[model samples]
Target: MPAADAEVLIVGAGPVGLLLACFLGRTGIPTILLERRSSRGPGSKAIGITPTSLEVLAELGLVDRFLARGVQVRSAAVHADEDARPRPLARLELGGPGAAFPFILSLPQVDTEALLREALGRWPAVRLREGTEAVEVRQESSSVTVRARGPSGGETLLRAPLLAACDGAGSPMAGLLGLRRRVRRFPVAFRMGDYRDESGLGPVAHLYFTRLGSVESFPMPGGLRRWIVQATGAEEPEPSFEKVEAQVLARTGQRLDPGGRVWASAFRPERTELERFRAGRVVFCGDAAHTMPPIGGQGMNTGFADARLLARVLERCRRGGENLENLLALYEPYRRTGFRAAARRSRLFMGVGTLRAAAPRALRNLLVPVLTRPPLSRTLVGHFTMVNVPYSTLSGVLARERRLRLAGEGQADEASGG
Candidate 1:
């Protein structure tokens, strides 16, 4: 009978949470977003934003800002160690009959978060609480209560009818809800960094496969380039600018000065997914729902898609007096299917790139040229850009309708003793 604090309570102010807030606020829904960190972290954890995500941002009126601040990658050049010179084995162009923005945009994760936060400033209905960490979450029959600690070490309780958990892979909220998760850790480790360089690569991303391992380079905004090299093993030395430069030189036969290197870190890719994306009134999105390897750069983009879909569902619920529980139930199957497909694709990419055996590697090298041509190349581009990933609400509705029809037919036959 009492009015809740806000219509929706969102955890984590990362891109997914911020974008969700933007969507809710734009639709005139009151939302409160809580973030554990006081500020955005340094460096770009996830750099590649796909075309589908750009389309979603366009709908939110934030694509122009992203385009201005990000670098447009039109093509990808894959190379092998056999070439005398660092020549591309296959150059796959990423522009075709997809969305308006067909190419992938390379922007720092920090910049993307900043832009989302800036856009949220215009939405008066969204309140962001940075440095506020949710310590516990309790779900009642009709509402959810979140207990959070503030910067001054004081605790506060906020209640809302809906909760969106966007808190990343090690999601505390998901843990609090006792959700089951499947996580897979790969043996591959990578060291990556951004450097100030004028590599003639320009808008073209480069991927080099050598006897040592795979090395990837993508041009960033403001004369900067991001380089990532797959490590030999987990016990390999700590990643440094000097080491990355040396690896690039050895793998691709290209000289990259280590000077002006901005940030560098090491990471091992992992795949994680929840059995479902919802628990009562609390729903999960972004890394909270699923996390895949960074090979296709679908992790963040997938999260963006999650936010867009949930916002649509919530907006519909607000307009119509529909049962919120039934509408929210649709989020799990729709998103879990996409997450599984994307994760499998990412694993295939990593597996192919890290083929260690001599015979398979040779065969892959010989077949890659043919695979990167024409129809196959186009398919690969579409898959990587996420244009091929289906996120249709109509499909869900049609499936539901079919189920209802079948149930009705069964009841009729049983009642008539047929």
Candidate 2:
């Protein structure tokens, strides 16, 4: 019950941690955000930002900054190699009048982090220490203490009532907490890069399902486009501009002469989620909690949702003098369930897109058109854009409201002697 260094000690300064710090700081709660990396890295890791995430940013008054720097994707087309003229198997329209931000936005992760950092500057209570790595953490009955090494190899201890872990997939904190993880790796690898887009694809995202594998292309904010191709047989092949260009040509019969290549890398997709999202006083968020395949682009957006909800819970506890433990107890189940659903959806997309057999591929290509019409089409769009994710505290609020309403009605009926 003694005074701690800060109200919350947040590990990692990615989108999740940065947004959490901003939220807590705005609520007048002291926060310390630590980042091992001194600077943001190059290239885009997660490009698709969902409408729900935009709504969360709007609540924080930071959505317009993102809107100005991102490209709006209104439609997506899925093409198969069976057609001779590059006909689309199915086209999903993302823009509609029902939603506030009708379409998904494509912005590089680096840019997203920079904007978050800028937003965090408005709050004077947040202390961000870059190039500081957390090396040790200790949890006591009433407080948590973290030992970190600075840039100059000096050690310092930081204590707080709560700890938020957003350190990513290879989180040392998760290991230190001794949480169990379930992970599965895909058999295939992918090569992805950002290139000067001269293909005239506009703002439409394209996915080509060929005999070899799948190729995805999406427009970026600048005059660039991101392309991801499945590298099935090449075990150690280098991901260069030529490899991606060749794959596109072989699959879709469309030649793309990329003007310049900015970034390229090969990676094997893996799905990972922890058994639980909390341990003692430490709570997991973002990649620290769950990691999914990049097929649906739900990874970062889901993390943003986690940070948003956790901020709300923490703020309520801080202001109302509520028990922090009771409020935080709701976070893990809500977020874990959402992550399971997202991982399942992502896995299904990966499986369908990477089908190379004739029977399954034929069935998928034939049924895609029919399933992508009317009601079914809307569901597909919702899944891809993550608008359908129910990872907020709204569900709990609605349930509580329903119970109160029922009780009031019962009292009214009793009073009437009915």
Candidate 3:
């Protein structure tokens, strides 16, 4: 209704939103980032940052900050069945020889947000408004407007040329805009807790597929470790440390002390993807656009890739002589293509660890060892690190297609003597 307040308005100041804001802000773009929470929330949500994400951060010169504070997970050992002297079925090394970041950086989500927030402060063009929630959204041809309620119970209208909804899986903006999401909730649930690292495994991650269920142990910062156990569906959603400890011990034969626990929770994994990523001037980013099980650790990293691509699109549209329609038209299809590939990768990782039946479990045990060896292991690690996935913009895809089409035409011209 009124003149645009900023070039871009971002909903949800989570990791994805913050990073998106930083990316835009670095280019001196005017952005308004909104968050409903009054302050940073607690809990270690995502612990693994893929090499691709590190490269994205490296663009903003913040990778060193993350590398300084986060743990480097260089390898993960896969083991089958619990034994007194349990041996690994296979040990897969992360990051190839020519990789920019040779390992997955393990940092809690809170710290990651803090680092992004700190970087955002460097750009005065971007303003982050906390304790402000978007209640209504109106999109027109020229711009999008959002009616938000502040902490004092007052409504304010903020308009922007573009709106990026990085508000997370339960994004209210997606609902307000009537975006349709295809959601599939998995039957299996899991409980995880951060505890002191007593596994003597050092920086390596250990994944155990036992008769009971799957147990994953990963190294975290501050000499802490995170353990995730597949829940039996009877435990409470906010499971106690004792429950997690018992499951880990039964599955991996690793005795865990509840007293050493830092944080714990239980959740049923789900995959949700929007049918369309854009509606008018509004665009969905991060978990607001797609969500996958945390088992594979691609959810947030994929969102980072989304922000990277979206930033490039917005930057091009802002610089002039670019058809914004042509750019935005292929955004959803290209991102959905990448999201589906990443989702399949997540499902592949889940399948091996979550097998229950004797036949499937035995097959997985036999297959994992072979899969984690030499040439094939590089492919698996590439999937894990996301270095091999085509998590990029449609601009590149279109360019390649254009090249092929032109080449075909050139050949046809030569044949016809034109």
Candidate 4:
């Protein structure tokens, strides 16, 4: 963003922005990227990637690096109670042709970003300027003017034919444009921490849907683990690590290490979608356009998908003036549909995982069996694993909405409908 001009000026240098840069670089498109952060932030967030996402990585020739560092979780385990035996949610029975590996993979968002940065290092056309933050953006008939500040007290400017705001959920570009994105904040708070421990917990991830609250753990690369425990949003932000561990133990009925903590933070599972993903010469991508709960982690993966589609759409347009009028059209339905769909699904998962209230927990415990029918757990587990995302096409969303409305009598039913 510090240059006087660029072909493509990307807003954020997070996973979405950098991966998009790598893709455009591979496809021989010149691009420049800017990020607000001086360096990678603490904490391991968004640690899951689906089969469809892996396929896209394969297309970028970056899957090998991810495959090298990530664990191929062919199966997942979800339990109704802490000590209750976990069950296989979904087995990777099918991956369409040209797909890269059929199963889901686990790699921290940071690790994914590192791999993308390395890939971008190979391309000379792609320039990355970290420690830079965008404060203003102005779009004209043929170009965009972006003003930014460096980590130090330095000012910079970038002029480009096109602009992409991948700056994340709190997108300045979207806000400045007066774009109102719908953000549905759940009345739930999850405290997540990463640690180093090789426990009896198997290779698969664990989800405990207990009456008190949910306690879950996910395995990361190099003997590291990511754990989450629900907290009542009403009480202060979150009690403390001691409180988090105590509740985690109470729910799972298992002893856990409190000293192995590497990173800890509390976050709400909220979903938001930009009202308009495009403007004159500026557009939005990834978290800038939409963000959802980190439950299934479709957040980063979905953003990566947006970057891929957007870059391709721009690449395919007639090569005359490169005004981005045609490419901007592809940004909406392709990305918004996925963002909206994933947000709705993650909200449903949040309800099931945390079971926020006693009444809702009882309602679910009683009704889930009736709805899922024979082998109820066996059938419903697939929904939690994100296996049904791509397989359940948009056309079926309306039908699924009606079915959910008739089953549960509340907002869960309504939100799932949208």
- Looking at model 3, the pairs that clash are none
Model 1 residue 334 lDDT? 75
- Arrange candidates, best lDDT first: 3, 2, 1, 4
Q: In model 1, what are the clashing residue pairs, if there are any? A: none
Error of 1 at 230 (Å): 0.5
- Weakest 10 consecutive residues of candidate 1 by summed lDDT: 390-399
Weakest 10 consecutive residues of candidate 2 by summed lDDT: 392-401
Clashes of 1: 0
lDDT digits (tens) for residues 348-371 of candidate 3: 888778888889887888888898
Winner on lDDT between 1 and 2 is 2
Kindly report which residue stretches of model 3 are placed more than 4 angstroms away from their true locations once superposed: 82-85, 234-237, 393-395, 404-418
Residue 51, model 2: lDDT of 91
Query: Which lDDT tens digits does candidate 1 get at residues 128-183?
Result: 99999999999899999999999899999999999999999879998988888998
Instruction: Return the top candidate by lDDT.
Output: 3
Q: In terms of TM-score, which candidate is strongest?
A: 3
Q: What would the TM-scores of all predictions be? A: 0.93, 0.93, 0.95, 0.83
Candidate 4: lDDT of 14?
88
Please give the lDDT score at residue 34 for candidate 1: 97
> Which candidate do you rate higher for TM-score, 2 or 3?
3
